[model samples]
Target: MTDLIKIMQQRQSCRSFSEKPVEAEKIVSCINAACLAPSACNTQPYHFYIAHAPEAVAVAAEYCKGEKVNKWVGEAKAFVLITQEHAEIPAANSEARKRDYRQYDIGLMIENFCLEATELGLGTCILGVFNEEKLKANFRIPSPKSIALVIAIGYPADSEIRKKHRKPLEEMITYLR
Candidate 1:
């Protein structure tokens, strides 16, 4: 149980990666874990595009490396593009609901990927500041599908997870009688 706690505590968004290449099996292992994340009504309305080769990864990174904030993306070894099947899932995208359950599902999936990556000694940085148009063009993403988030994964230059600060449980939660 301590090992799990350590992995949870140590997982951080890595901005820098080592020159050493990440094994394909490790990437697949993390993604396989991601595939098991729960979805809304079992819709599972999303897709993952993985870029592993240097040239392919670089191309994907270009879309996310917009300005100063996301410049760190260029250094990551791989980028996983998460796209939502919005048009196809019209029944779930109701504006009146004031909530996007699909987005919530996507978040769960991404977290699963991150946790698995951390467990396998890999690093991940989730990026949403990229140009969607460029992503669509670069990846040839079909219309009606939107790029929800991109995750950069690889071995970290510094394998240490920096200190994580969070509000105490009491501050963020309350029990009901």
Candidate 2:
């Protein structure tokens, strides 16, 4: 397999994290990679709110602890809150508001961020179940912007990499050719 494939395989939704804190430089590198991802009409239409401080992490963790499985998010040392923004497509004599691509663009960026994090020997978990109102209120996020996802980042408590359970390629792919 190629290096990218190996990195992809290594990326997983980490639920358990160590007490070790994630480095600021590494997080910035990951963000830089995320920014390289392609977006609709070249409009990134997203912003990342990073909380690496202990207090900020704790506050963000509380909002992410929505369901039972996510309770362990408190262990993560850092959190990246993704917010969706209005995409202004500059089109000449064309309608640009027919469809929304903000979610797709955000997903691509998140994947790039997570993949870079995995390559940097860090663990990440993309969380969709969070207290949006509380997070917005506490973080001072404007009412117009919506929270897209929350990413928990840190070193894994467990050293061993678990096998990924996924559908087979044959079942997951369909070819017209």
Candidate 3:
């Protein structure tokens, strides 16, 4: 548990990235680690589209830029587009089928991905302010599939780990026991 906590502490949303390109193997490792995340009914309703080539990364970066958000993604050496896929039975045929678990699954996978990247000395920033339509069209994503998030990945220009702030556990959670 402490090991995981350390990784979490080291992981931060990096906005300043160096021009050095991220290794393909490192990206693959992140994806593989993400697949280890448990999903509802074993339905991993997500796909990661990697863009590392200069042209591809440029296009993805352009789509990720918003008026006042994610403008720093342009310097990332690679981008990963997390796309939401169809979840036939999100509840595993249980009675609580109304609640879709795809979003939760995606969140778990993304956390795993980020943790793995941090362990590998890479930096990542998750971006949610992208032009989904442009990304879908440019990346050849089929209709009905939606881009849930975009992650900028590369070596951090500043290697120092920043402090993380969060609500205390007593305020954020309650134990029924």
lDDT of each: 0.82, 0.92, 0.92
Tens digits of per-residue lDDT for model 2, 1-177 = 999999999899998998787999999999999999999888999998999888899999999998666988889999999999989887661565678889999999999999999999999999999999999999999999999999999998886777999899999889888
Candidate 3 on 1-177: residue-level lDDT in tens?
699898999999999998787999999999999999999878899999999999999999999999888878888999999999987783457764777899999999999999999999999998889999999999899969999998899999997988889898889888888
TM value for model 1: 0.87
How accurate locally is residue 135 in candidate 1, as Cα lDDT from 0 to 100?
A: 80
* Residue 67 C-alpha lDDT in model 2: 66
**In candidate 1, what residue range of length 10 has the lowest lDDT sum?**
87-96
Let me know the TM-score candidate 2 reaches against the reference structure.
0.95
> TM-scores across all candidates?
0.87, 0.95, 0.94
Worst 10 residues of 2 by lDDT: 89-98
The local distance difference test score of model 2 is 0.92
lDDT of 1 by residue, 1-177 (tens): 697787778788898988778888888888888879988666677888888889878888887878778887777888888898752445555662455588888988888889999988889988978888888887789867899998998789985667888888889998889
Candidate 3 regions with alpha-carbon error over 4 angstroms: 90-96
- lDDT (Cα, 0-100) at 64 in candidate 1: 84
